[model samples]
Target chain A: MKVSSVVWLTLVWVLLWGTFTPLTLVGGVVVAVLVLWVARQAPSTDRLPVRPLRLLALVGYLVYDLLVSGAEVSWQVLRHGPRACGAIISVPLLTSSERVVTLMASALSLAPGAMALEIDHDAGVWYVYALGPRGASDVERTWLRTMDVQRRVLATFGTPEELARVRRLIEERVA
Target chain B: MITDVVSAVLMLAGALSCLLGALGLVRLPSLLSRLQAATKPQTLGLFLVLAGTALRVDLKSAATLLLVGLFQVITAPVISQIVGRSVHRSGGVRPEVLVVDELAEERPQDRPS
Candidate 1:
């Protein structure tokens, strides 16, 4: 059992209860243990190779994107009514890492204008639902934007080898 | 005084975001688009409200509010993903609204009845 998982789950339990009583703490530990024991799988032992500066950059971009997209969507709602254009463009995945994919999808979903509808990690593609990408050029732009999101995610959390792999993949695509 | 003013601004902005989210829910044509409104703006609104509340509260309670925001951020996307997937699978979206549907084209066999 990963101590960190136990500790994190227990913290969640305590927070949910909104109490730090001894009984609450004990109950949290017991519940965490039971959950972990029941759902026993190969724990991911790899420590995340987080690049702090890159992670900060990713976060900053997400926040800005969120605000801008939110305003854009809101304006669209008021001005355009129900006639807004929606598109589902599949973007090729750069890295096949599950964690990176999950993070990228979540970040994309959290921003207002785009949401990932389906992720085929095995196929190395994400089917993303985007607002306002209408024509062939717009779809291509949206595809590149999704790839950019994936690139930021890879840079922030990927190992050095994985980062190099992504760079190579991009270069190959360009070539 | 400055803190109060800032907090009020944050809270008001949060409220406006929530209103817009609700408006989108009613105005948007499709389920996926509605889900976009339901999840995204509401999330930002909640976060802003939590931030404003954290600023006004004592340190300990502020920590709790921060946890609330953290949990919301972590879980919101998961919820949206599940719902979005279901909608996509069930063909809840109108074809006219979608300019490009690569998912349907890419995996024709996976289409739901």
Candidate 2:
């Protein structure tokens, strides 16, 4: 089990119990280990490569995006009433990695007006469902915004080859 | 005293956002659009409420609430994605509201005839 996941669980355990004794800390560790062990009983998936600095950058962008998107959607929801010009757009996936696909899926879902409705990692494509008060002109723009997110995800965790392909794809698609 | 005021304001803001998210959920025309509203602002509301709670609590309890907030941020999107995929595959979306369906065109096999 990854030490970080275990430590995180223990921290959560400690906080939930609202106690800070050595015995409780030790007990938290035991419980965390047990939880990890149970999680391991399932089929193992490929390990995702996480570069801390890049992840920190992603987190920073997500925070900013969440605030902007939340406020934007909230405004649209209040003014336009949720039916305003929404579509499910198909986004081309540049990377072949399942982990990378998963990364982009979660990140895109949280980033403002777009939520990933379907992901077909094998076919190198996914569908994003976009919602907002955007008019018809903005449909292309919304799809392009979702592509921009793919670029960021590739930059953060993708291999050099994958990133290069993404760059090429961006030039072809975005430009 | 100042901390108390800050906590109260933050909590109120969180509650307002949460309320807005719920309203969006009810008001959205379709399932896909509703998922967007259910996840984004609701996630923010959660973070704000947790922060407000952490600020008002003792040190250890504060740490606990902050940890909970962090986990919520990490997991909320994944859950949203799961729900979205299930809905999409099940044809839960209203076909009329969709102005574009590029995925359908690309995969004719999956396209509904």
Candidate 3:
């Protein structure tokens, strides 16, 4: 692994788990910095560049959706019964990167009614099971739209053209 | 004591939401729908639980709890995205209303060799 990748991973680990123990903190910091140095020597330059304002908006939207849908699903299960639930829908993806794809999966899964089950990297697809009043078509559309938002956000970090191309590809495949 | 009561209530609510979400996961028909059930309640439930814990605990632990919450808020979506896209790419059918398949166009080589 590149030093940069290692560094970033370490930094993330420390940031997330540093509170667990002093040893973890020390180890995380040391390993992270060292890995970062190695990553710097690596020669891959692809990055997802996202605008800050848009990113914030995306986060806000996700949070709101999470709350609303969480309540909706909970209410449905409580009032109507589980039989009203919808079917599993498979969503094809434009982006192939693990980070972007996983982010998409986690986001959907974290929502109220959906659970992302598997990721087929070769096919660039995500399988999600959503439970709600919506039909299969509606669910698929929602998933696509949500992923579109993520694609746009990813574009902000570095390569707009690449992101656009990815978007285009996903659209074509679905068509 | 009042603060403790509030904390207890929040914790209970959080637990309820979590339970509801888990139930939805079991009851939901589709994987996509289940994903919906799994993500939201877990996030909110966890947030509430953390908040309640913070209310009842020391400052450092509270800070840690908040940090964990923030992490969940950040990473949850990313994970969903990955899973959703993978499902789609795996030949999941799309709605008729959809007009385009961008991913397909982008990768001509994705076709079978």
Best by lDDT: 1
- Please tell me how candidate 1 rates in CAPRI terms: medium
DockQ score, prediction 3:
0.26
lDDT of 3: 0.63
Off by over 4 Å in 3: A1-25, A30-44, A90-92, A115-127, A133-144, A155-158, A162-175, B1-9, B25-39, B70-113
Q: Cα RMSD to native, each candidate? A: 2.4, 2.6, 7.2
User: Of 2 and 3, which scores higher on lDDT?
Assistant: 2
The alpha-carbon deviation from the true structure for residue B93 of candidate 3, after best TM-score superposition, in angstroms, is 15
lDDT of 3 by residue, B1-113 (tens): 99999999989989998998899778754444455567777888998888889898877557668678978877776666666556555655342222233344444343223
lDDT of 1 by residue, A1-175 (tens): 9899999889988877777899989999999999999999886655577578988999999998889878877876787759978899877776656777788888887665888889887887778998766688878777777777777788888777766776776667556
Clashes of 1: 0
Minimum summed lDDT over a 10-residue window in model 1 chain A is located at: A42-51
True contacts kept of each: 0.70, 0.74, 0.37
Model 2 / residue B112 / CA error / Å: 7.0
If candidate 2 were superposed on the true structure by all CA atoms, what would the RMSD be? 2.6
Which portions of model 1 miss their true places by more than 4 Å? Answer: A17-24, A45-47, A165-175, B109-113
Tens digit per residue, CA lDDT, model 3, A16-87: 663657787678768777766665654544555557886787677667876787797788667655455454
| For model 1 chain B, the run of ten residues with the poorest summed lDDT | B104-113
Ranking by lDDT: 1, 2, 3
Residues A1-175 of candidate 2: C-alpha lDDT, one tens digit per residue: 8788889889878877888789879999999999999878554466566788887888899889988888877886898784555777777888777777877888887787788777777877788888862456677778678877887887788877877876777678656
Best by DockQ: 1
